[model samples]
Target: MGNENSLREQKILSYTGFAAKANKIVYGKRGLRNYIRSFQRKKVILIPKDTGSRVKLDVIKHCQIFDVPYIELNYTKSDLAKTLGKQNISVVGITDENIIEGILKTIQ
Candidate 1:
């Protein structure tokens, strides 16, 4: 999932293995997280933690049109590599919402 095209679009998502790493580790902002959650299964859905060039056209369209910045973060998995295995991704999302949740939820 390490492609320049995906990197330009979203941050690489690292699998935060079995430790509920998303809500706890990555995200620390409540307001931002709640806002992002609202978009879930609605106007916008959180991209998988490892969204590569495989992103869908509609998601890409929304990200481009809305300027929402499709993003990810490999740190979540890296930090917990001993638990979740090593992630190949390098880039991850900024601490807005998606990455935060992924980090907290990603187990290790």
Candidate 2:
């Protein structure tokens, strides 16, 4: 079970890396808020476990209001940031349809 979980995490990390490279991901709290508000495309917001409760609540509320889906990752903010080659990323919104589909499929 542990090994399976690790593999899933690895796959998610790989997809996140690809999204970052393709410019399909919106980073930071402000960016995610703006993207979810203005964009009508299929997207999945990745909120790491280490994110502050207040920020997480606000993000979730926005997602609910906009009918967007979000995932609270088991990984921490630093882990996610390192995967995307960034620093101090609190939230991430993936805008690519293919990546969104791929991640949702993996989760289920």
Candidate 3:
């Protein structure tokens, strides 16, 4: 793993059937209403990649331990500020794995 944080983010993305980017993920979580509406997958989550946030870190670890897919990027990491500098990210795409393509299509 290159960066532990990046690896953690990548792990979450893979389960959702997404490939690697920067050896990590570059997607949005709950910060964007449209992105939040994208998934209908079971056991999925949209967590942010912020280590300083207790809630995000704990949730990320739990998802990784369980092999759950998650969206891990946020507005803070977004160059366009697309997600409103997203904060308060939690459960997202918490559904099934099959719907991910449609989810990414809608969100991306």
TM-scores of the candidates in the order shown? 0.26, 0.89, 0.36
lDDT of each candidate versus the true structure: 0.37, 0.87, 0.42
Candidate 2 residues 21-101, lDDT tens each? 998889776788788987557788888889999999999999999998888888999999999899999899888889888
Off by over 4 Å in 1: 1-20, 24-55, 71-108
Q: What is the C-alpha RMSD of each candidate to the true structure, in Å?
A: 11.0, 1.5, 9.7
Best by TM-score: 2
Candidate 3, run of 10 with poorest lDDT? 18-27
Give the clashing residue pairs of candidate 3, or none: 41-95, 41-96, 42-95, 42-96
Clashing pairs in 2: none
lDDT of 3: 0.42
Q: For candidate 1, lDDT tens digit of each residue in 1-108? A: 356544433322333232234432222234334434445332222344444454434455545665444434333334433333444322222333454455344321
Greater TM-score among 1 and 2 belongs to 2
**TM-score between candidate 1 and the true structure:** 0.26
> Sort by TM-score, best first: what order?
2, 3, 1
Which candidate ranks first by lDDT, i.e. highest?
Answer: 2
RMSD of 1: 11.0
- The clash count of every prediction, one per candidate, is 24, 0, 4
